[model samples]
Target chain A: MNAVRRRALLAVPVAAAVARDVAAQPAVEEDFAAAERAILAGRTPVAGGIAIDMPQLSENGNSVDLAIKVESAMTATDHVTAIHILAEKNPVPRVARFALSPRAGRAEVATRIRLATTQTILVLAETSTGQVHRASRDVIVILGACVDGG
Target chain B: MIGRPAAALLACAALGTLAAASEIRPSRDFLSPELRAQQDDPSRHPGWLWVEEGEALWRRGEASCQSCHGDIAGMAGVAARYPAVAADGVLLNLEGRIERCRTQHQAQRAFGYESEPLLSLTAAVALRSRGMPVSVAVDGPAAPFVEAGRRFYETRQGQLNLACTQCHDENAGRRLRGDVISNGLGTGYPAYRLEWNALGSLHRRLRACSLGVRATQFDFGSPEYLALELYLASRANGLPIEAPGLRR
Candidate 1:
């Protein structure tokens, strides 16, 4: 066979493998996309002014401590208005949403949440001036030994 | 060179000293620093969710725990001394005692084992005893039960043919897959286990261990587990209770 034809034949299998992988992407990814879109509400969220504090490795997916902080001036005119948490791979990607005001004094919240698997978590914060900021973190959740729930 | 008897005596003495030097460490010490910190902060601790439920349950109905016991804090040190022989001579762990109170005192139905209300109330009560040393009595009427528990701990059972001592005693502080094996102390139960994602009793944990070893899983409040709970508590004699503890 000609060298060009041989290379083209090899590329066909490689292309098929790539197509297979794209088709094999989990449905949860689409779930996350939809959830994120719902939260964004047609507005683009800029990546910054927000931070997520959580363990990089979680011993179990059951309950993980998470904290989100948004950089904002706590004033009536320039405060954080809301915070939304999204887990990219959880059955329900929307983890929580907290509505706040200048009365909150700070755009910080800490809580324990369940992660369905090892996945990226996104945090979005909305300011009083209609600006949206975002941050994300990846957590590796190890499966528990006794998950039979016996 | 020493005589045979003298050599045996020396060996025994060495073993005794080794046993004496094995300090009792809380399971929290085995957890990652992040989990350890989670256990300390109520706002960040999922166990507090159960404790909060327990607090509300404590005041529910006319025959509430608060109506009889006044402030729940008044029961401090009570959890630290559980798996004790009750007035009626029945050996009872904290959960058993709570169950008894609900049924006999409150004229209510049994909450059954591992029930949410039971776990909540047990955790709430145990939270009050946090930092107090576990002081379950292994003597008196509790003697036979404790002895049975010790036997259960030492005996090799299940398909794995492993005794509790094999791992928790001899191989503690070592890795068991992705997790570290902790010294088997019950001080931190009615703890919130990340595995269970909820607060659970030491009995539930014991049942999980039984299942892990492929042994006969006992009922939640079985006498066998009650005896085991007493023995474990006695072993933990002076370790501070970390009930509603966060555990992996």
Candidate 2:
């Protein structure tokens, strides 16, 4: 009986073994938490002024468009610091960030991101004022998308 | 030409089917080895400025982009098909598309829908897809999204205003204020738009359209913008994906 059981356990699927071998994957990324902590901790980015925008719901949960706009006068004294795109459910949390200056003309950037599942996306900005302005939005993703009504 | 709505659709069923078939399939294979080589090979890299800029941005962290998406490729080819409709039946471009992500789960602000910073990162991410043919699934109740997008493409917007057709179709390859107007292809976007001094999103590109027409800029993440993105994405159909593309 022991010999037979040993053979069955040895034949267990590779995926199952691997699943048990490694730490269970967190559904969302890690710095996703750390980034949040850093900004909320009142640490200002070198440059301040940021904005975040996104859809209320991601029906596909795959490719999600995102943008950030920082409030700035575009003056040397008061210029946009940076724009960062952060996500919760992707394998890596921070999607992308852009550093802006007076020459940048606008304290903003536009881009697309791959969202693994519906999760929080944060945009943080550091302004010349030693102030950090942040904007956030909630995204709802419908699993097994029936949005197309097909 | 008038008939019951249902009957009209049924009568035009074959035509719709043909259009559908044509809309989704690009003439060229998206992932051909030749194209892929031109897309991601860093040494043969046609545009290092974008990569260089992106890399510097990557390091500026705690709040840097890398803090979120480390090594874009580790995530795979998912970047290829986007600005797609969601399963919940909402048509979202990459920008206005993921609200649940930004606020609820990540406890972070969402990137502004179709704003400048978003364009830079989206372009950066898309560039990683270099050579991948643009592909968007025209599935779900997405048919309406597609149709709306198509209509928006042909419809006129803006003051000194223009339809995409005026330039892309009629004057393709012609200079517009000293710029060579290519086929209005979506092949390369989150592209480095020189005028903008940074990368631009297709919705922002359309916003420039409204500006040209002297129309008010649509609020970011509006239905009008979504429709336009869908249309533009469809237009790039067979063109090789050249995202985070460098443009004059």
Per-model DockQ against the true two-chain complex: 0.19, 0.01
User: For residues B95-199, what per-residue lDDT tens digits would candidate 1 score against the true structure?
Assistant: 888989989999999898899999999999999999987777655677788789989989999887989878887888987756788888888898887655568
lDDT over C-alpha atoms for residue A130 of model 1: 86
Query: Which regions of candidate 1 are displaced past 4 Å?
Result: A1-29, A33-45, A74-77, A128-130, B1-21, B52-70, B87-89, B102-109
**For residue B196, what is the lDDT in candidate 2?**
41
lDDT of 2: 0.55
Residues A35-110, candidate 1: write the lDDT tens digits.
8888789998899998788989887665678988899988989999889999887666788999998999998998
Give per-model TM-scores. 0.78, 0.47
Per-chain TM-score of chain B, candidate 2?
0.69
- When summed lDDT is taken over every stretch of 10 residues in candidate 1 chain B, the lowest stretch is B1-10
List the pairs of residues colliding in candidate 1. none
- Per-model C-alpha lDDT, please? 0.78, 0.55
Q: Candidate 2 lDDT, tens digit per residue, A67-144? A: 677767879898767666777755667778788878888887877665655678777776666667777677765342
